[model samples]
Target: MKPPRSLLVITVTAVCLLASQGAATWLLVEQSRTAALATAGQTVKRTLGTAAANINRGFLQVDALLSGLESLVAPSESADPAGPNRKLRNLSDQNFLVRELMIVGADGQVVASGLEATRRHPPALKSSLLADDALPHGGLLHGGLPHGGLPHGGLIVGDPLRNRLTGEWSLYVGRAGRWKNEPVVVVAEIPLSNIAQLALPETTTAGLRVSLERTNGQLLMSNPHDARNTGQILGPVSDRLTPGGPWAVVEGRVSGRRVIGAATPALHEGLILVAQLTEEEALADWRETRRVVLIASAALAAVVVLLAVGAVLYLRARDRAAASLRWSKRLLDQALDSMSEGLAVYDANWTLVLTNRRYVEIFPHLRDVAVPGTPFERLARHAAAVVLPAGTGAEREAWAEWRRRAHEGSESFEQTFPSGLTVQSTQAEMPDGGIVSVHRDVTAAKRAEEHLRAARDTAERANRMKSEFLSNMSHELRTPLNAIIGFAEVLERNGAVPEAVRIDYARDIRLSGEHLLAIINDVLDMSKLDAGAMILHESVCDLRRLVGAAGNMLREQARAAGVLLRVMIPEEPLPVLGDERLLRQVVLNLVSNAIKFTGRGGTVDVAVVRAEAGGLQVTVIDNGVGIAPEHLPNIFQPFYQVDGTASRQRGGTGLGLPISRAIMKMHDGQLEITSAPGVGTIAVVILPAVRCAASPADEVA
Candidate 1:
């Protein structure tokens, strides 16, 4: 009756193998379903969180708009009320969200309204909402308030009320403040439709529903347009709702469909945002996957029943192919990782195909989001958020869009990060229309280039100053030499010249030779000072005597120019320790310059007095055509003449002030000049009191 033992063993073995395969397949399907549900839950959570953030941001903007209206209303009583009314009207026109703007006085009287008709015949507070007494004074609002609460300074966001004038639903924002001297409230009415737009998602995904509700359970808006559901009460509050939490997942019914949903609190305490998807819709993809897997498993079972021996051979071949593929992938990854530059490749659809380690290191924030199938736009947005400075959402969006366009182009470009690293990005097109981008850090090279440019500019400026100095010196040297030569030739020739004429020629030649010698001496002194080779020949000298001697020397020239020369030396011995010759030279140069620049009948006064800082000051003041204010700072620079023609006509090289300053510096003193264009010039020579002595030592010649 029973089968043979050998046949029974084979049948038992086959049945055991088939049962094991079925159990394994069921376990795998269950794991897949669990993973899929988790992923869907996260998607719903993120979507709701983003929607809540957007709604909060919108309220913040509305609050800002309301605050701005305060300034107009707060000053209306003090200024012309008509002017603020016009301004309110203009503000309402500019902001589409603000349907109406009005100001209420301390007595709850409508002081100014944006609506012209209402302004002509100001309406009383029609809705009892504005007459609420619970509103606080002079603070910002964060949560909802009961009906009939007035807010001062702080924002009061009220529930939607039907506008008596337009017969439309509108939300009111009220801020109380003092206008002129009386208390006033500025109110802005926003249409419910506008608030709904802010809560609605920009792009709706398939099988997803979004609803916005007030704290009182009234539905303000819902996506997918269920007219019967709008303005109705929400089914129930989720037990998972946590105060101040970002978002929470819960099971609820939305628009007559039982669904898994996420709820998040918006900026306003009463406002809640909910995003939902039906259970059937959420599991649709997993169900399809399960169906396909079941069909495949049934076909494989049939094949095993028909050809069990062939199935074993096929499994072995499949294992070998998988091993080879894994080995190739490891090699490719290693090759990419070895490269110095950051490398990333995207497919023709602009979806990331692969990214090396270096790329992730350079943009570590991208590592979290840059998967194999991620779109390039997502990566660009991440970069803008992390690498760029703080900016508005729109600005960041624009920057991301620009980056996308640039990446699509063939040209190479540079991007700079907040870390101060600059990257040179180069993109190449693959044969299949994909792109490979490489980023090279070039911060050091860019810094070196900037340094080189700065050095070049400094060198060029120095070279130009040197050339100018040489040209001025050449002109100065040739003038005196030419005069000396011409006068000398006149004296050398004409042996039968009259005695007076010969004396005059000799005198002229001597003067020209003296001028030339003085120029040469000044140049040599400057060189010695620059080279640190000049030595001070210190001695005790009479300051008064020195001033008198300088005045006497320049008296003849002063007389010739019809300028009076006066010396105001103190009767008391004004003795000083310094090189007498250098002191005399400094005084002579100052006096000579004064006389040369003075007009006819102008006076040159050399006076000596005690300085405030326990020093002796010798001041040479001349009522001459004074130095211009613009040229005063550069007067002590070598070869710097205020007017080249005037300095030449004055018959001296432009080295007088510079040499005098240097001599003063060597004596541990200072020389200062102050002058006005039309007024006279005052040159003060301050010598330290320590340098002064009661008596003169053997003075150097």
Candidate 2:
């Protein structure tokens, strides 16, 4: 290429531009690579860490289960040697994960269980109970035993159940049971496979190779190993065993693929647990990042080349540039001063050379303290006097640090003043040994945050008070209302009472009072719940008892209203954990509402069904007048009714569903209502299942 008139200018511009572009490109490339590596490492760390954390959590749950086992098996608790107790039953009922709970004595005998009798003793116990090597040592023991049914996968959490006063190993035959032949275990199992299921739900790595081997170099379980390879040596056991050494983390090429392996020794067992991920698979994220970085670097280089060409042409064309430089300076100053943030300029000696209007506005105290070209020490002293005392100790130190750092060339810092104002200060060192500093206010943001916090606290407190007041009021009012309704019914049923007057007066008194009480009770419960004073007392209760009681109580009302009332309880007893009284009330309310809303001769049906969400569902279906679309939302509000006057005539407090909803929630349950404008409404109550049927043996011979 022929040399141009501005060859020197072109060369200098190109060098500077290329140097800056190269620096930017290198920074971008390194940042992308570092970020990808960080993300991949974090994914692996969290996956493994969460699995280990869950395993530890399972230990806690096992402790709780074991602590109560002795009491469940005591002779006083269960007369039959293998019969269950309330506590043991609570385990199966309250916890859904436990397919079967059994207390294995020191001798490994199956003492008590939660499964049916036929399956409970089905030739499974002969191995663990008879074999010397079968008793689990404790911690997490993963594998199949000679149980021979669906894999008897289990975790053995070996904690000694002790007497409260004696501090002795109270390992006794307490509780046992089986359900659905699902893999039953002691406590909970936190297998790597299960952890992978949660952490990589959609990943095909589920089928990836994994291995768990004993310290003896024998494989316990391995995805790549066959059944015959289990407990068989693929490598020398002694060489593989680290034996209380630090966990092994190895990365190397294996089978033409890079693999990362991490191994940790089991604390409870001597076995070593190992995890491996192929580097090609793990680092797949790097390819796309590299591609983007290369493309960006090429584009940046092209831009710098074009900029250099333009600067070269301009340099020769701009022989006289002092006028342009002076104009640029005036423009820069005007722009800085016009900005909202405070701006000030200082010389190398820390003297104030320039101050914008905002600078003067921010530091009013410095208005008379410092004149143009005065030393900055005057302004610093004024700022410290105005802001230091109002700051926290750290804030004050941070402010002091900013000034010190500012005294150093090219340093930038920020600080919060005593007026609840945050100020960000930037220092730009000038070529002539001067500095420019700017301050921007951030106090509005701080005030807004404080206001939001105050509002949130106020709302939370109000809700708590409302719930507490409601619960307290419910307790106080129920007593007298119960007496009034009871006496009224008794008098109306007596043969001695005059029939004509007794029927009219008794009906009116009982109906009016019960309706009023239901409303009062509902309002009180809502308040109590809002106040956080309501507590749920959960226990296993028969679904039949709840449905039957509600049906019987509402039968007369249904008949009087010319409505057909029917209840369908499962042949198998539905067991749920909840307050019996509250549950019964919920059923009664739904049924009663159906009866009241149904025109004469309408039909109302109630059914209890077991649900997949580990709960019993009580559904009340009715062919009544049905709710209006617009009124559905407000139907559950206190004292609200679709037809207020008509609902009054029907003698309802409108608090029924709302109170029922609150009670259901207390039990970790909820009430759902689905209604059609004319077809009818179905109210469903969901309660967590607490009772699992005692295995067949307890029921049969």
Candidate 3:
């Protein structure tokens, strides 16, 4: 009898599954071995690349140092040989990498040396290192001219050599220049150990060896510096010697042990960096990883079939979480950018972690310097260099240090740049020992504060002046009104008195009333000027006649006060366009003030003449006790009296000069006054040339 059909099918399926799993397992193991070897090659390649970058940077720094020395050796009007020599010595002492500094002449003789011993016994140049027929011609110099040639004010890095005197391996960096019409070179010698320190990593994996070599395969540095292997060739030459070159890797026998090797050209010219690892050492970790991966693959194949549905759900959830995280980061960035104030966040390690757009705008100078992972001190130094006021040496360093310290504190402070920009910086310390800083511009606010202070001071001053004027006006008006009222009362009850006494009282009342009327008129004129309500009825009038009329009106008063009054008028009529009445009032006020201020025997002179620029000028001069210089500026202000007691004694309001000036301004003229304490005062009124014309009308009476 035949077996059941179901049992036959199950038996066939089991056989096929076993055969496929055995093939897959063998294929997976082979592929893992190849991937492991590729990973090892990549590891060595990266290591070599890093070493190359470090060496390139070291050479660049040395080139920069040599370039800086060019300016020191260049011709200067205040050239001091001893000073430059001392500076060179100081620079060499400060940099641990530099072994010596020397100024070499065109003939290759040492002119000046930083070291005292080198100065006394200068070493001769090795002809082989600087041979004319060398590959680079002048040496292995870079950074300036090609073929190792150095241009004027250019730097070059020369071939490495053993110093004849010191017996130390050194690299030469030099700058070429002409000082006092002689070709001069400033050269620095750096020891190989210093270069190694700059280019080599501090620590590396065990059994790994790093070698720095020239393009010619000559080893410049070896980590172990084995006595048997020193100065030997470093394997085969690499074709990748160009800038940004790809790293090359190879499997080779080194020190009689199979190893994986990688090589890359340093960014510096004619230099290559190589990294080597013994094959056993390099593949040890990979072998363990392979064993685990093989075992896990077998188990995973079985479990994958059972848990396929659950794996799909887990992957979907992970994708959703990743998308949400990306969205949150974008939202946070937008929120930070929306802030008006500049914001920067630093991690606990003092490295910049985040910054808003406003921060870049506020410190545009720091755009290149302030980036993620930048140290706080680096940003501070850049800020000080770009924004701080001009300072030298120690002062500049101090400013940078102060800025660094200021940033470290949580206090809010203001920083003002030389460009007149001001920013108020506030810092908050996070719970996790990080820091958040916000910078707000306060330039406009500070300016507004200054303006407000000035306005307040001006208002206070005006208030004080107004109060004094009111007090003086009250005393002046009350005195005149009191006398008029007293005299009027006496006159009204004169029926019981004699006719002569009654007449005397009447005259006294009339005089007091007139005096009061004058004071009222003066006040009214000042009020009109202040309110800008005064109008001018302009017409062509004779200035000479006006001066004569004013002199005549004040002549009697001047004589009464025992003062001499004089009028000097040009024979030709000086025509001016102005209101006749106002012009007459202006002249009258000036003449009156002159007469009132003059003492006995003092002279008051009024003159009218044709001024330069075809204008009309009127002068009122007085040989009186003149105004003090300190009081002259305020003399044109209404009710300003040089001497308040004198204003009362003279029986006149102190508005004459101010009123006159206002009328002159209305006519497009100017009133100027010059006075000395004892040398008397001179007041001149200048009318515009266009307003003056040949007029037939005489000045008003």
Candidate 4:
């Protein structure tokens, strides 16, 4: 019993379509009315304009004839002034259209006239000419021109002339007579019925009539049949007409229907040209156009209704399908809110349409204001929120880089801030003409990674310090122990008393005491370095002397091992500033390392040079059962030796090179090494330039 949803949807859509069609129909009707009114107005203006032009031309022609007559008799050098005036008066009488011509002298005397002599005296012409008004006022004077008892009306053109030699103007006048030679004073007596006749020729309908009126409300001319007294001058023309010479008048009725009128002023005079066409004739063609347009409009409405009904059904089906697909809408919204990352959705114009909780949290100030709608760009600027530290030019460059990548559709990217916050952001285009932005904060993750790396480096540094201390301590203690052992052996070798008992006691004491002392020294030096309490004994030293002393110190040990020992010294006295004790210790360690590694018959050499480039080089070269390629790289690492057990047997602590490296570094120098699998090893010490003031012995003493 319920209507199907499709039917209901169709019904709603049909209602909308009907409304649209009605609007279209109203628009069409309005357009037609506007067109009709415009056409009517244009026609009226065009006909009026043509009539004005014709009237102006006719008025000017009359004026031109009057000017010609005036120039023919200039009064200035007339041998007999009265005689010349008489001759001009005779000239005016010769033309049938000229009503009168008169000569009035400077003294206001009517010297001569074409009319009766008594009637020719001036009344106002003298005062009018001398006044500051425009020149030669000659047009319809309602009282008509003078003379032989008939009305004379049309136009009058007058000019005040000055003789070429004398500078005074004299008035000359000519006129158009109303009926062949008869003259009358009033302008209305001129037969303008000729003009009315010409306005509508033979094709004009039988009942139509045209007439012309003067601005004074007096009729000049009209078709004989249009004698109906219009109670007053009708329509716009008479009320608005301006006063002056040289204008025309037009007025009329058609079929005795509604009156219509238009008027225009003449070019030469202020006269108006008026025209009228009544309603019956103006609307004669309207019925046909209205019939055609109305029929067409009705047919168009029927077609639109049918098409609209079909479209309604189709659109309803589409709407239902779209409504069925709304399952994911809520889920998507919840996901955006749930994210810890800042998420925002923007419309096509980049206005922010939606922002998640994280976005609101990050930019809390935004909550106090209106929520930005539909475009992200309309919100606050991104650059205003982000900042970089000064002097980190590289960080500022990253924003420029991000903009370039964004324009190129590089949708996802990571950026790090000087505040040490790192963010990964992505841009996603939404189906509804918008973009969704997701930003994840990475500050904590980066800081944690940095902390872990620092910890590993700290552990490595501590282990190296331990091994270095052990090596330095062992070397220091063993040197004194060697001296003790040598002395003990010398005593046992004297061959006095019980030699066997002395020898055993000497050997036990020598071995046990030396080992214990070495351990004690290693532990002490390690403690000093760890506590940050190690001090340097700085003094000036001769480099050549130090190298020689270092060589001599290691020579006996080298000889005991059956390795050849050699020393090279620079001829020039090399001066340096450093801790002489550590410097000497460094040399001893290098030489000992050479000796320990050398084979029984192999050679060990120490060379000191005034290095060419403003430094000193001391190299220890040894040919032993040489180091392997892999073992050579880590040989200087603390607790790292090519052969660990063999190094112990040869009396090494495995931290000799590390201790030497630390000592050289304290003195602003470095130890470098090079080795091959079966070739001799080379250890070189390079020291920076230093100014030495006094000798080590002098300073110590």
Pick by lDDT: which candidate is best?
Answer: 1
Candidate 4 error regions (>4 Å): 1-340, 346-438, 443-447, 450-501, 504-508, 515-519, 530-532, 538-540, 571-577, 625-651, 691-701
Candidate scoring better on TM-score of 1 and 4: 1
Tens digits of per-residue lDDT for model 4 on 87-147?
Answer: 5557655543333455443333444454453234343343322222322343322333344
Rate residue 650 of model 1 by lDDT. 67
Identify the superior model by lDDT, candidate 1 or candidate 4. 1
TM, every model: 0.41, 0.32, 0.50, 0.34
Task: State the lDDT of candidate 2 residue by residue for 1-701, as single tens digits.
Answer: 24455767678778888788778878877787666555544444444454345433543455456543544445553366445533455675664333345544323333445544413442233232223343444211123333544322233322212223333222211112222232223332123333233323333542234445555554544444334554454563345334333322244322445444444554435444544455566556666776777788778888878887777667746743754676788888788778999988888898887888788777777788657878776666556767775667677566656676676646556677656567777778789988878777767776788999999997795676456446544544565577567767778578587788677766667775865666677767767866988776656667676698789999998998899999988766555556777778788888988998888988999988877876668899998878878888876665455654445446544567778888877777779898986688999887665433333322321
User: Best candidate per TM-score, number?
Assistant: 3
- For each candidate, what is the lDDT? 0.74, 0.59, 0.73, 0.57
Against the correct fold, how does model 2 do in TM-score?
0.32
User: In terms of TM-score, which candidate is stronger, 1 or 2?
Assistant: 1
Residues 532-571, candidate 3: write the lDDT tens digits. 8888877777777777877887788888999999899978
Worst 10 residues of 2 by lDDT: 168-177
lDDT of model 1 at position 236? 45
In model 1, what is the error at residue 272, expressed in angstroms?
A: 99
Candidate 1 C-alpha error for residue 152, in Å: 99
- How many residue pairs clash in model 1? 2
